[model samples]
Target: MTENEPALDSLTALDSKAPPRRAAVIINPAKSGGPALQGAIFRLCETQGWAEPLWLETTVEDPGTGQARQALEAGVDVVIAAGGDGTVRCVAEVLAGTGTPMGLVPLGTGNLLARNLGVDITDPVSACYDAFNGSDQAIDVVKARLNHSDKEQVFLVMAGLGYDAAIMADTVDVLKDRMGWLAYVEAGIRKLPGKPVKAQISVDGGEPVRRRIRSVMIGNCGRIMGGVEIFPDARIDDGVLDLLVLAPRGRLGWLGVVAGIFGRNKNETESVEYFQGKSAEITLEHEQEFQLDGDHLGTGTHLAVTVEPDSLKIRMSI
Candidate 1:
């Protein structure tokens, strides 16, 4: 037996009469850890006397939704998203409300969903064990409609528009490959000087709140890069979406925005405004960069986002 691959002989022996359980791994092959993660998951399944997993590699044209659908069609026990937040989002887009629990291996640069789920980001063996042995915890999924498109996409962690999305769109791919999440810092610094766009935001179909905003971030869970808590009180199963509208006032207004985010009271600053509701509709004066779970999805003049609580069953130790 390989090191760290638990000895599950007793359990397997006891369940010998039962049908073998299997998993479907929807992975992004572009991720560097793809082969290693697959090997680890395979070893764990063998150790646990489970059937070999059905491996599906994501492509540039189809990230993960098609593969996840294929996994569902195969009737696997769980669908594992073995890549970054984008892959997680794609798998989630297909698994939500289907009652098929999803697992995570966190192989991408920004493993935001895995981080929030407290998965073992640094160890493939441990993450693979969790995928096969962990408990189910239902979480919220945010559905976003860009430019009022009938086709909706789901994000598990967070989504952003304007400056934050600009950073995602502008980050150097080579730098990101070498520097990881820190590449965002460099891109953010360069995009900090852009003009704020006029936005009309309506929360839960209430009165529209009009303002010029540098960026607007919507969150389902709190933590982000470097363990920063962007939405302090946000919960994955809260059934509500947390919105942060950033409008830095002057040359040094970003400092206030940082303070408001990290300070004791995030709601008490003019540079940052916080809102919570079931849904939000944001209309911008013009098309701006938009992103879902750190993957830039071109530009949009309008976005309608709503929270679907306890819609996604994520298998992870709580």
Candidate 2:
């Protein structure tokens, strides 16, 4: 077989001396600059003497799960997610537990995971280089199992309900494409006027704590857009999950909460509450929009979430 064969995904280099590195790129074609990015990736592979990466373009329906699985089955040395958080999350879900390091090539808006890793988001070429020649790190992942459908998902950054999820759900696609992350601010402003959501949440087998909240975000990592610190204590490898509860009552309270998070004092106000846990069971008084990472899932009243620490291996800058 040729040296570039897909079967080279096994860690043969570790067993012996260093071997050729084979990578796979799972891309979402609808993202901006898709064609240019693909060309750049191929050229880099040729110039760097790396194996020709397995290229998989994702459709809106498939995202990256199917393509990522295919790459894994073919034994790709590393899987690169080349889109936004949704695409990254999909690829990470498939790569988890395989011990195959997943790489990040940020190509979409709100590159939350990439931002948390300090991956170069502005320069695709530099980002690709980092992904290809990076060190491996083990991070935690959240396993969210829906109560109504038994549907399971993996969230890499944060899973949120109420106001945060409403913002994601209400974000206009065209506006988001035009204004990028700023569109979320616009949506958040519009959503702030709405009534708060009521939910009962129990953490790590504790008693249910019911509250009327503006937003309840459970984070695997604390970084969010606009440089806000959603949960200051949350770390990707900490073996624990951090929760942010914003119970702001009105515009002034909302301003206070925003100031708290934006100023690095997210837990300093009564309107904002924080908790850490290994698992969370949340039941909403009424069906409300929810999001994992940033993708808004349909309205649901029940959410069961568990964190598995050191479960996924990811690539970071060397």
TM-scores of the models, in the order given: 0.93, 0.91
Pick by lDDT: which candidate is best? 1
Question: How many Å off is the CA of 266 in candidate 1?
Answer: 1.9
Instruction: Report the lDDT of model 2 for residue 123.
Output: 89
Model 1: residues >4 Å from true position, as ranges?
A: 1-16
Q: Enumerate clash totals for all models, in the order shown.
A: 0, 1
Best by TM-score, which number? 1
Q: List the residue pairs that clash in candidate 2.
A: 9-75
The CA lDDT of each predicted structure is: 0.91, 0.87
